[model samples]
Target: MGKITGFLDYPRLGETSEAPAQRRKHWREFIRHLGDADASTQAARCMDCGIPFCHNGCPVNNLIPDFNELVHQQDWRRALEVLHSTNNFPEFTGRICPAPCESACTLNINSEAVGIKSIEHKIIDKGWEEGWVTAQPAARPSGKSVAVVGSGPAGLAAAQQLARAGHAVTVFEKSDRIGGLLRYGIPDFKLDKMLIDRRVEQLRGEGVQFRTGVFVGDAGAGSAYDKVETIAPEQLKQDFDAVVIAGGAETPRDLPVPGRELNGVHFAMDFLPQQNKVVAGDRLDRQILATAKNVVVIGGGDTGSDCVGTSNRHGAASVTQFELLPQPPLQENKPLVWPYWPIRLRTSSSHEEGCQRDWAVATKCFNDDGAGNVCSLTAVRLEWKDGRMAEIAGSEFEVPAGLVLLAMGFVSPLQHVLDAFGVEKDARGNARAGTDDYRTSVDRVFAAGDMRRGQSLVVWAIREGRQCARAVDEYLMGGSLLPR
Candidate 1:
């Protein structure tokens, strides 16, 4: 809307990353943000489309056209305000989101979509550089208390919103630090840990209390990432007026095949968090290292791609990724799937670095070396017909795999946590709660994020958290002024 003819004059310009050879040497963010002029030009490409489907495309419903116009006008202050109005953490989404908003752009029908994500990235980065980001503390206290369980995007979002609304908010994290998946599940190469630390500082300034290494459940010992300081589930109910369960889906889907007990096979969650800890200057007695070993990452998803990138950084001899489903088309059929998420092949930066990617391949079993160490993987090709999958005859093969990382994705939240709260569960085993109210069967308990919706993107988690906060506020008070 800033420039009527800008779309015709400018082509989409994306952020550039350092060469794989150079970037893999360190665990830092390598993607460079666009310059001011370039970012303005990209923002100017936003058309005055009668309806902005991109707003709906974004899970958080970001005001895309408004921010684009502000960036094009070089009003960085206003741009940041507009971004923060909807998203609590644009820096996170701008860096990692799949950008469904661009896929739903009207210009995408016949031309390249406007670089909305890049513009967002530029705005947020500029905000931090100009010292525009600061803590927003409430002027008055509401005299109510809320306990937010877990500190992922959802929990963090809800805590910030609730705190701003003048309620006393305390976030409990099972891990040693805040940010559940963002802190541990994601690889450091894509997202630096300092970003999370920056936000944590701001959140503390906003009057949100963070209780780390405090497991609020059936009070038990913690895992390798966090040592346990137990808090009974009933204690939270007695202390806080309301409790929001934002603990994400952590029950990983397992591949129970032969040699699963081998020494080298591990869940992606177990493998990824260790590397993050090491990067943060923590020493581990027994760390899973991919160095000089043939690594096989099973499952074609973001987690699997992360495994490939981390393995490459570890100087693995080779990295191979396996996908159970058939490959999708390189390009989407926009005519048929316009204004919605499309089925298309996505090549992550990790895949481009160096990886052998195969689709429609299913692992049958893990083969072990003589000492009960995983040495190879047996797999078979599959054929899909009429929505049914069948293995092809004579397609069995084995590949060298000194280390195997299972990244098939999470199945549900840990049942013990749900049982501790005594909350009802959905058919998928997610915490039973509706988005309309986010209220669980228990009167004062609520659920959001992956705990309520199952596995999803970071953006969706943030959206759920924000909405859940509003629901809690409305229930606590008569109504809330917070945006939905």
Candidate 2:
């Protein structure tokens, strides 16, 4: 609440980006941060609504109104303090989160909402610039230990909160690097990996131990797997005060049609991680080059966008993305969908690079050339009737594709890891853990993140991790000062 009339006086102005042509040339963050004047004007748009629905919209329950007022007053330091009181990594949420709180803003009912995400980004960025972000490492150790499996936003948030709550926290990551999806699945241009590295450094300085390339169980552990440490659920139950499972939902969706096994077909995960490793200096005997090859991406989510970006970086001949459902309206019916994510045709930055996007399309089959490589792809158009897709007759077509990347998302966490730990699973196949308590069936063993919530946003994962940390602390020592 800056000025009583600020909502009417100010219009929303968020961050801008460099020209798409220039940004696509290299893997680097391209967002142009809003200036103090711009940010303050945007913050002024947060109206004096008695009931701030933005709180419910934000998974971390950030005190958004107070921060808006402070930002309007140009009080960056206090704003960050209030922001950090609930969220462990405001800097992270600011950068990658989809900002549901903005949709729920009072002004969004009729006018453009306050640029909440932009203000959040500016607040945390200014805090770090002013060196206000530092390690508090708890006043004293509680002599408790927590093993958090996964180094994504959720795992990192949980580990940081538990460590700050005076518990010894160790985070385990199966990949060679940290930041599960954030590190490898996402392209560097959207979120420069350096941000993650800097946060990891802060967590390290705060006494959180991170062991990368360490498997929690046999799910991802191949025969030649070397464990930095073995973690049996039984042992974790006995040795540590509590164990929190925050591993990702890594089981990728696959296509089962004919010729799928051909050389050119691959999953989005299979293609994405390899490019990430190559960027990190890992040598590839034969690069998975998309250069001058006609490429097709299946699924129209963020992962597909990443495939598009990486393919452009690889200098592809052309890129096409297919989605099964009908195309959404360019603009959402905001009056009906206000305070909730709306159905709209969301175009990503990758699409700006270049992509032929088609919705209401279903992949019929993959046809292979005699040499056992994908040659032609067939698709059929669909019509939505009674809330389901009905294929349109004679609307079939084929495209010449040298490569196809499946980005259809994941179904569940790997079965073996859940099986090995003997944790009960929900109907949806995620580890069964309640948000109210975050406890799995196994005593003192909690679960969080994608491993528990199914495929979700990075911000939700961070919220679960923080809440799980508070739950573990409560279980270990009668109650917790940690924020839930």
The local distance difference test score of model 2 is 0.87
List RMSD in Å for every model shown. Answer: 1.1, 1.7
lDDT of 2 at 262: 92
Off by over 4 Å in 2: 220-230
Q: Could you give candidate 2's per-residue lDDT for residues 101-169 as a string of tens digits?
A: 988887888888888888999998898889998877788889989888889988999999999889988
The residue-by-residue lDDT of candidate 1 on 1-484, one tens digit each, is 7799888999999998899889888889899999999999999999999899999999999999999999999999999999999999999999999999999999999899999988999999999999999999999999999999999999999999999999999999988989999999899888888888999899899999999998887654555433578787789999999999998889999999988999999999999999999999999999999999999999999999999999999999999999999999999999999989999999999998899999999899999789999999999999987889999999999999999999999999987889889999999899999999999999899999999999999999999999999999998998999898
Q: What are the Cα lDDT values of the candidates?
A: 0.93, 0.87
Off by over 4 Å in 1: 219-227
TM-score of each: 0.98, 0.96
Error of 1 at 248 (Å): 1.4
- Give candidate 1's TM-score: 0.98
Best model number under TM-score: 1
